[model samples]
Target: MPRDADATKERILAAATAEFATHGYAGGRVERIASQAKSNVRMIYAYYGGKSSLFDATVAEALRRMAENVPPRPDDLAEWAGDVFDHHQRFPDVLRLSMWAQLERPEATAEPSEAYRDKTLAVATADASPLSPVDVLVFVYAIAQAWQLSPAGLTGLEEATDESETVAARRRSVVIAVERMLQKGP
Candidate 1:
């Protein structure tokens, strides 16, 4: 593909990601994405076949980026959780997109892709513990995402002295918790 075409596609994906995150697949508008991308609506359909396909492509790209940039490190689970948390902080849209997928596309069924299976398998066999690698992963992902929603980690807390302080504290908490889990015995 030409450089210009690739750039245009990226813009479309960016716009589409934001749109899906904000409005979900049911509420997201093709016209709005096109407008945001400064491209014609027709091009989206031409490029992605339709709104559903565009959403799938948008999510696929997000997953691909996560798998590539934050591949799990089974040997160092704490660091891996921190890296995943950082990725979530950097690309908050990915979390929103993931939430929208769960809430709005509950009926859509697709088997886990090979990349996902490999990562889960890697974690499962990386160490011996009462909890399986898959369970540890689930625990880490849940806490990290929950922290994103409430960085203070509990209700009725005063705001942080600095935004980065809250993130640092939350990251530390996640890392420590995962490390402890890794040290547990069956």
Candidate 2:
């Protein structure tokens, strides 16, 4: 693809990511994505095939970025959990997109990406804990995202005072929880 086409595609992906994260696949509108991207509906169809295809691409790209930004650390699962928590805080849209995919694309959930596969293998090889590798990975991920996915009313307690301090405290809690889980095993 030419440079202009590449840039346009990126813009479309960004717009689509935000749209789908907010509205989910069924409710996401290609027209709005097009408008947000400063491109037209025809281009989105031409570039991504259709709305469904675009949504798939958007979700894939978001996951790819997350894997790149927050690759697993098998040796230090607690720090890894902290990194994941930080990633979610910095890019809340990624978590939203993930949740949207889980709700709307159940079939797609079965296939693990290479990044996830590598992480699982690393975790298994590095840790001799009783917990299965998959379970460890899932547990760490759940703990990392717990704050972000919590009810707004619950989170409001953290945000009631100094935002940075509360967020840092939450992050510390995530790290400590993961550390304890690793130490205790399952």
Models 1 onward score TM values of 0.88, 0.93
The lDDT per prediction is: 0.81, 0.88
* Residue-by-residue lDDT tens digits, candidate 1, 127-168: 645686667777878766767676544733846468788778
lDDT of 2 by residue, 55-106 (tens): 8888888888888999889889889999999999999998998898899985
Best candidate (score: lDDT): 2
Best by TM-score: 2
Tell how far residue 18 is off in model 2, in angstroms.
0.8
Q: Against the correct fold, how does model 2 do in TM-score?
A: 0.93
**Candidate 1, residue 178: CA error in Å?**
1.0
lDDT at 152 for candidate 2? Answer: 91
| CA shift of 182, model 1, Å | 2.1
